[model samples]
Each structure stands twice: as structure tokens, then as C-alpha cells.
Target: MIPSTTASAAALELASAYQSPSLQSHSHRVFIWAAAYAREHDIAYDAELLFVAAMLHDIGLVPEFDNHTLSFEEAAGHIARVFATGAGWPAARRDRLAEVIVRHMWPEVDATTDPEGHLISRAAALDIAGKNPDDFTPAFRAEVLAKHPRLNLVEEFLTCFKSQATRKPTSSAARAINSNLDSRMLTNPLDAN
Candidate 1:
């Protein structure tokens, strides 16, 4: 079961406040996917931290909190750290949470160092790009998407990433867009009409 702590609740509230409906749904799907992956793989992790990290991984994309100069991942990491610190999380915990948020954007993450980071990274790719649909049963995917429908997520995600790329040309999102936006955008299994 996904753990619910005060910090995790606060993270959800912040995500709701900043994320668009599509993005909010996406965040929830990320959590569901990550948790499901953990359960299926028998990977022990802190569910509360994973929940918070998955929910707020895209917080930097929110216009109100975004610093145009920094990559969205970096900005989101700083914001998550600030939120965790305000919630009285220990420095180590806050740093770990920040690492989870920051690393979600990476193409790959080493699970040994940060299992939460690795799971969230894999889960986000699965959610966004349909990278490993076979890992989760079709029933699991149906259940998750039924609870939080995509709401035209592919288009919404591309638009958001395009905006970020435009503002921060050197950002990871920009590099990704330049490299293969169309292929990634086209790969979402949920978007099939």
C-alpha cells in the first residue's frame, strides 16, 4: 500500500495547486505506476517518499515557481527540497527526496544508489513513453488509467515540454525534444484512438 504522511499530503496539495488537470493526472499515474512496479518487483522502498517524489516531479514546469534559467528538473528538485524542509523532514530525507525528483528526468538511473529514483524514472518513462508495457499487466494499466484518465496527455505533455525547451534551450527537456520528440510523443500506448 502507498504510505500517506503529512509531507506526502502536502506535496499532493502543492501539485494540485500548480499542475494543470492533465499534468495532475499524469503525476498521479506516475505514483501508481511506480508503486505497482515496486510491488511487482518486490523492491522495498519508502512509499511515502516515492509518492511525494512522483507527484511533484514536474513541479518546476509550473509557471509560478519556474526559474527560466534552470532546467525544469533542477527547479523542481529545489522546490521539493524547500517543501520537505518546511515540513520538518531531516536534511538527509529532504536531500533524498530532492534526488528522486531531479533524477526522474534522466534517461536511466542506477537502482543500487536510489531505488526510489530508479523506480520513478522507469515509471515515468512507462507512463509517458510506453517504454515497458509488458512489465505491468493489462489489467493494472486499465485500472490506473481508468482512475486517472489521460485527458489528452500526449498533447499536453508535448506542449509543456515545448514551452520549457523554448525557455531553457540547454535544459534536458530541450535536448530530448531536439533529439526525438515525435517518436517519444507517438509512443504513448494510452493515446491510441
Candidate 2:
């Protein structure tokens, strides 16, 4: 059987092809932001794994999906079989991550209690909120702004994502996450997201 890491790597690599360039860049920015949030809160994360996971969280956004909005449940279900057979993730671990992935969507899953879950959930939310340059089509932006008059922070967060999307990852930040694993952050295995 292929090792879990190797399997995950393959899945992530395959996932890249299906993502839009804009979505891909935004995904990276989202992961990095989530990582930053995790660090600030001193949550223990498998940074390398989380980075890869974050990068591919929306792998199910196939070009075929109209509007390209993949539900968390669908994404999780798609990933579970792929990870289980190809990556050999332990059954328990697979179940846990799958639940987290499926419920990662807003109004469905809450990540406030678990550090990693929060990172994944918020990162996806920020992406869906579409505050990025590529994401902001004139009509969509206008609609979104009007629809979410109170979500200024999310709008601001997208602005940051838009600006930073073009920048390279910070060397120090990457290094820090790579080295630290003792964050001891809480993880709710049963939480939906």
C-alpha cells in the first residue's frame, strides 16, 4: 500500500489541475492566512499537512460544476474514498478529517472550538466570500457588497487576500510552521467541520 503522505501528495497534485488559476492563488493565500491565525492562537497543527490540505480543500470544484461551488459534504465524500484507497489514511483519521471537511461550510459547521478545523473552515469561508481581485467581477462584487453590508471584515480580508495573492510565501513564516508541532491546540474529531 502506498504511504499516507504519498497518497495525499498524489491527490493534491491531481487536484491542482481542476482549480482555476485565480482560485488556486486564492487558495494559497487562504491557507497562509489560516496558518497565521493558527500561529497567533498557538494551535498545534501539522503545518505541512494543513498547508497541503488547505490548498486542496476545494478540489471538488470541478469545471463541470456550474457556478463551481462545491458543497463541503460532496468535497469530503469525494476525498474520503480517494484518501482511503490511494493514501491509506487510517480509518479513524479518515473518518475524522472527512467529517471536518464535509462540515467546513458556513451555517453547517463551526470551527471556533478546534484550531485546525477553524483554520480550514475560515480559510474556505474567506475564499467563498470572494474578496480577491480575480474573484470580484463587477456585477458579483456589487451584489455581494449589497447582500452583505455588515460583513465588512470579510470584505477587508478579501482585500488582503487580493493584495497578497501575488506575493510569494514568507520564508520565515513557512519555516516557523514547519518546525513547530507542539501548539497543543484543541481538535474536535466529531465536529462536522
Candidate 3:
């Protein structure tokens, strides 16, 4: 189940206000995907923390929160930290929230150390690039898409990454472009199916 918490609700609200509907839906699906993966792997995770991180993990990509210098994930981490602090989370928990968001962009995260981070990283990859589509059944995938349709996400996200790459050539977004992220996204099986 999606975590029910004041902070979690607020995170969704924040993303709704600043992000496109496509992006907002993607954020919610991130949590759902992560939660499912956690269950499949028997990984213990903080639901509320993971939910909140998923809701705001792409906040940096929203034009309102987009940074002039910081990479998008770094900007997202900072935003999550500030949001968590306002929610009355302890400093360490706030740090963890930020760390989880930033870690989504990383290639790997040890679940034993940061279950939330590992789930988010894997789930975000699944959603964005269609990695591990077999991890969830076809019916489950259909239901997810029915509830949160792609709604032009492929177009919007690719454009966002291109813009991000031009402004921040050293950023992961740029690296993704160099690594043919566009082709992977365009040919993503999820979008096709």
C-alpha cells in the first residue's frame, strides 16, 4: 500500500504544483514499483521514507526547481532535504531522504545499507528505461499503465534530459545521452507494449 502520511501527501502536492501530469504520475508509480520490488526481494524498507523520496525524486527536473549548476538529482536531494526538514523529520532522517533521492541516479545501491535507495534506483530504472520488465507480470504492468498512463512522458523526459545535458554537460543526464539513453527510451518495451 502507498504510505499514508502527512509528509507523503505533501510531497505529492509539491510535485503536482511544479510538475507536469505525466511527471506527477511517474512519481507515484515509482513508489508503487519500488514497493513491489521490495516485496519480491524480501527487502525491508521504510515505506514512508521510500514514498516521500519517490514523490520528490524528480523535483529537480521540474523547471521551477531546476538548478543552474547542480545536477538534477543533486538538486532533487537538496529539495527533499528541505522538505523533510519542514515535515519535522530529524536531521539524520532528512539526510537519508536526500541520500535516497540522489542514489536513484547511481548505478548501484546496497539494499542492506539503504533499502529505500536500492528500491528507488531499481524502480526508477524500470519506469524510465523499461529495465527488468519481467520483474512484474504483464497484468500488473497493464494495470499500472492504465492507472498512470504514459501521457507523453517519453517525449517530455527525453526533452528534459536533452535540455539538462546542454546546460550541464558533466551531469548524469549528459552521460545518459552519450550512452544512447535516447535510443533506449524511444525503443522502450514498456512504451511499445
What lDDT is reached at residue 186 by model 3? 83
Question: What's the true lDDT of residue 167 in model 2?
Answer: 32
Residues 114-183 of candidate 2: C-alpha lDDT, one tens digit per residue = 5556677665554443222232234543443343232233333333333322232332222222333112
TM-score of each: 0.95, 0.53, 0.98
RMSD of each: 1.4, 16.4, 0.8
Score candidate 3 by TM-score against the native. 0.98
Question: How well does candidate 3 score on lDDT at residue 184?
Answer: 83
lDDT of each: 0.86, 0.46, 0.91
- Per-residue CA lDDT of candidate 1, range 34-140, in tens? 88888888888898899999888988887887887998888999999999999999999999999999999898998777889999999888888788888887777
C-alpha displacement of 174 in model 3, angstroms?
0.5
**Candidate with better lDDT, 1 vs 2:** 1
